[model samples]
Target: MTGATTSVELRAHNRVRLLRAVHDCGAGRTRSQLTRDLGLARGTASVLVAGLAEDELLHEEPAAGRARGRPTQIPGPHPRGPVALAVDVREDAWELAECELGGRTTVLEVGPHDGTPEGALAPLGEAVAAHRRRLGHRVAGVGVALAGPVRPGGLVDIGHLGWRSVDVPLLLGLGPGTPIAVGNDTAFAALAEARRGRLRGVRVGLHLHVDFDVGGVLVVDGRPLQGAGGMGAEFGHMPLGGGDRPCACGAVGCWGMDVGANALLRHVGLAYGGGRGRAQAEHVLATSEEAVAAGARALGRGVAALVNAHDPEVVTLSGLGAELRERAGEALVAACEPGLMSIRRDRPPLIESSALGWRGALLGAMESVFDAFLTIEGLELWRRNRGDGGPDTPERQNVTNSTFAEDNSI
Candidate 1:
C-alpha cells in the first residue's frame, strides 16, 4: 500500500482504539488521559480526536481542572455519527435499539411479532430500513439476537420460532460486507453484561437470560466461550428435568422446559402465545415472584451442575425472568449448594441480576463493531506517538505488521 493508504489505515485504527478505550472505561475520559493510557503522544491524540470530532464520532467538553495536570478536554459520545443497531427477537416480541460506542442505548422501537421465521424477519427488515432512512449512512451495522442457536454464517434453527435451517442474512436482505452478526440472544446479553455491566472485573462468570426459553453464556477470564462454530453455552438444553416433558427442540426432559420463562408461565397456569392480551401477561408478571422462586430452585440445580464442571465465580440473570434473582435469591443459592460436589459446595457461585437490564445483547453487538475497527497496527502508531522513548518493541512491531498485512489481505 502507498504511504497515503498506510496513513489512512493508521488513522482509522487509532480512532477505533480511542472509541474502544472510551467504551471500555464506561464514563468518558479526557483526551490527555486516553493519550497517556493508550501510549500516544499529545499531538497525535489531538489529531485523532479532531478527526473523530469532525466525523461526529466523538464530542469534547472542557474539563473543570479536578486534577493536577494542564486543563484537558473530556471525550463524550458524538451527537451524530455511525451508530450500531441492535434487534432482540424473542419468541413473544421484538425490541430494536440504537447504541453508540460507549454503551449508551436509545430504544427506537419495540412491538409484538409472530415467532415464526418469516414473521420475525419482515418487521426486523422494515425496522432496519426505517432506521437507516432516518439516520442515513450514519448507521454502522446491525446485530440480531435470536431465541435459539444461531449456526455458523448466521443460520438459525429455533424450535420455538418454528424456524428450520433459516438463513438470517438472506432473510434480512443484508448484502455483502454490511456486517450482520447473529448469536443466541441470551449468550450475547451475557457477553454484554460481562464486558460492560454487572460481570465487569469477574474472572469467571455465567449469565442466564430467562425468558420464554432458558438460554445462557459462559464467560471465562472476560471472554465468552465460543464453541465449535460459535454455538457454545446452550445451558437451557441440559437434560435435568423430570420424566418426559417434550421440548420444542424435540428433546425429552430438557431443563429449559422446566425452568425457562415459558415453563414458569405454564407452572402458573398462563397460556403461551404472542396474542394481544396484556391482562394475562400482566397478571403473570404480578404473580411472577412466586413462580420465579420455583423456577429459581430448578435453575439452581442446573447451575450447580455447571459449577461442578466449570467453577464460574459468579452468575447473573437477565431477561423477563431475571426478576427471579431478586425474589428467590437466597432460595436459589441454597438450592445450588446441595447440587455442588462436596469440595465445590463451599464456594458456590454468586447469583445476581444483570446490571445491563434488557439491553445487554445490543451492547455486545456494539462491542463487536468496535472490535472490528481497532487494529493492532494503529495501536503501535499510537504508542510511537506517546514518546515512549524507544523504537517499537520487536513483539509489538511484529504483531502490528501481521495485523495490517492480514487486513490488507482480506
Candidate 2:
C-alpha cells in the first residue's frame, strides 16, 4: 500500500480501536487506562480521544485529585451521543428501548401483543415513533428481535404464532432512509449472555435460551458465532429420541418437544401458559413426581448431548430453561451423567441460568444495534447526519471496518 493510504488506514484503525476500547469498558475507563489497554502512546491516545470527542462519540471527565502527579480523565460515551432503537417481539408482548454507547437502556414501552406476527408491526412502529419523538436526532438506527427462525432479507418464520416468511420491514414501513437490523430473539439471548450475563469472560461457551422452544447461539471470543446465513444454533430442533407428539414447528421427537415449559407442562398432562399448568410444573419440582422428573431429566440429557458435540466451556440457560434448572437442577445433572460418552461423565461442562432473565433477548437486541452503529464509520455517518439535522442516512455509510454486520436475519 502507498504511504498516504497506509497512514489514513492506520488513523481509521486507531479511531476504531479507541471507540471499541471505550465501548468494551461499558460505563467508564480512564484515559490512562485506555492508552495502556489499547497499546497507544499517551500523545497518540490524547489525539484519538480528542478526535472522537469532536465527533461527539466520546466524552471525557476529569478524574479526582492525584497527590503525586497530573489528573487523568475518565472516558465514556458522550452524554448526548447516538442511541439505537431496540425492539423485542415475543409471543406474549413487544418491548422497545433506546440503548446508548455504555449499555444504558431507556425502555420506551412494553405492551401486550395479540399473539399474531402481523399484530406486532403496527405497535412496534408506534413505539419506535414515540422514542424518535422523544430522543429526536439522538436515535441513529433500529434493531429488532423476533421470535423463531429468521432468514436473510427480513423473512421471519414464527410457526407457533402463525407467521411464515413475513416481510417485517415492509409491514412496519421503516422506509429506505432509516437502516433497520433484525435478528432472531433466541440468538440475541445468547449474545446478551455473552456480553452482560452469566457467560461473562467465557471465551468459548454455549448459551441456550429455553422459552417456548429452546434456541441459542455459540459465543467465541466475545462474539456470537453466527452461521453462514446467520441461522445457525437451532439446538431445540435437534432430534433427541422418544415421544411421537408433533411439535408446533411440525417436527416429531425434537428436543424442544421434550423440554422447556410446554414440554414439562405436557408431561404432567396439561398445556403451556398461565394457570394450572404453571402451578403444577412449579409444584411438582419440589416433589418426587415421575412426570416432572422425567421432563427435567430430558433437559439434562439434551444438554449433555450438546456439550459433547460442541465442547463449550460453560453453558447458560434463559427463560423457562433457567426456571427448570432452578426447579429440578439436580435431576438434570444426574441425568446428564449417563448420557455423556464416558469421557465427560466424571467432569461435565459447567451450566448456569441466565442472569439477564427473559430480558436477555432484549439486551441482545440492543447489542445487535451497538454492533451495527457503534463503529468508526457509523459514528462518522451519525456526525454527518447531525450536521445535516436528520436521522442516520444510508448514503454516509462507508463501513471499511465495523463491529456489526448487516444483521438481515429477520
Candidate 3:
C-alpha cells in the first residue's frame, strides 16, 4: 500500500510538472520538447499527455507548418477545458476577462462604475453569474483584482473610494461553492510582471502601478512578499515625500500625494475623485507638462527609497509610471540619485516600464485562479468532475475546501 501511494504521488507530481511546462510555454510545445523540459522519457510523456487529454484538460494538435520528418503534435490546453474568470476593478471602471489554461485571455466586458461597493460589484456579480451559468462547471474559479489593500477572506480597504473593511465576497454576491480569489490590484499586477512580464526570471524585482495612486509589490524569485494580512507593498502610503499634503487615506505627507493620477490632477487644479478623476489626470499628462515633471520627480524619489530599503535587481513600472519617466527624462533620474546610498550609486537597480501595460492586473488575476486550480489535487477534482472513475481519495474529497479554494473568495 505504501509503495502504491508513493507511485501515485510521483505520477501526480510529474503530471503537474508537465502541465506547468505546457502552461509556461505560451504557444505550446511538442511532446519531444516537453519530454526534454520535464526530463521524462518519451513513453512517460505520452502517457501523461494521453491522461490529460482524456480528462479534457489538454490536447495534442498537429504543429503548424511542420516541415518534413514525423509530423509533430504540439500539446496545448483543451479548447473546452476549465477556465478562470478574471475581474479587474479600477478606480473608475471594472473589467471582466476569461483565461484558459494556456494564458490566452479574452476580454468579456468592461464598464464604468460609481466607486460605491454595491454600485461596482452588483453589476459585476450579475455578469459573473451570467458567465458562470453559460459556462457551467467549466468555470473553475474567479479572481478579482481590486484597487485597494485586500485582507484575507476578501475584505478590502479602498481608501480612495472611502471604503473600509468592505466584505468583497459578500458584495460580489457569488455566495458559496464558486471558488474566488481576491487580491490588491497592484499586487496582482506585480504577480503578472513576475510571471509573464518584464520581471520574469529576475531574482529580485519591484513592480509598481501608478493609477489613481502608487501601489506596488516586492517580488523575490518570482514570489511577491506579502506582509502581514497581505498588505506589504503599499508604497504609495509611505511618507517618502509629498510635504504635508493630506491624502485620501487620511494620512499626511504620503508619497501618493506627490505622484500618480490624483496628485497630477490636484496639482493641475483639475477635479480629482475616486469615481471620476482618471480622465482629468490623463488630460494633465497630455497638456500640463509642469505637473508631469513634479509627479515624476516624486515617483523617482519614492522608487529610490524603496530601492534603498529592498535593493531589488530591477524595478518595473506600469500604468503612468512609464510615461512619467519618459516625459520627465533626466529630471526623474536626478531625483532618484540623491536618495541612493553611495555604494549603490555606481549601479542602482535598473528601472524599466512593464511590457504588459494595462493588462497586468487582469492577467495576474487569471494567474491567481490558475494557481489554485492547476494543483495536483485540483487535477483530481477535475478528473472526478468529468466522471472518469477517479479514486475517491481523501485528498480529492477535501481539496474543494482548501485554503486557496475557500478562504480567498471574493
Backbone clashes in model 2, listed as residue pairs: 371-404
The model with the greatest TM-score is: 3
Error of 2 at 15 (Å): 1.7
For residue 83, give model 3's deviation from the true position in Å. Answer: 0.7
Q: Sort the predicted structures by TM-score, highest score first.
A: 3, 2, 1
What digit string (tens of lDDT, one per residue) describes model 3 on residues 1-410?
22336867878888888888887787478889889977898888888889888888888889989899989999888887878999999978899998988899999999798889999988998899788767755776889999888887788989879889988888888554447889888888888888898899999999989888788889988878778668777888899974797788888898877888888988978787675777678889989889999988898888889999999999999998888977885778889989999977888999898989889999888888888887887787777665322213344334444533543421
Candidate 3: misplaced stretches above 4 Å?
1-5, 387-404, 407-410
Clashes of 1: 3
lDDT of 1 by residue, 1-410 (tens): 32345777767667767877887776378888899998888999999889777656678888785677666788877776446688887776778888776777888988677677777787788778778656654555577887778777678888865688898867876553454667777777877887888888899898888776678778877777768767777778878645367777788888887776576667778776332333554466567677767777887888888878888888888865576667777877877888889988666677778888877776776666545444454333433323222212444334323432111000
The top-ranked prediction according to lDDT is 3
TM-score of each: 0.83, 0.87, 0.93
Q: Least accurate stretch of 10 residues (summed lDDT) in model 2?
A: 395-404
The global C-alpha lDDT for each of the candidates, from Candidate 1 onward, is 0.70, 0.74, 0.82
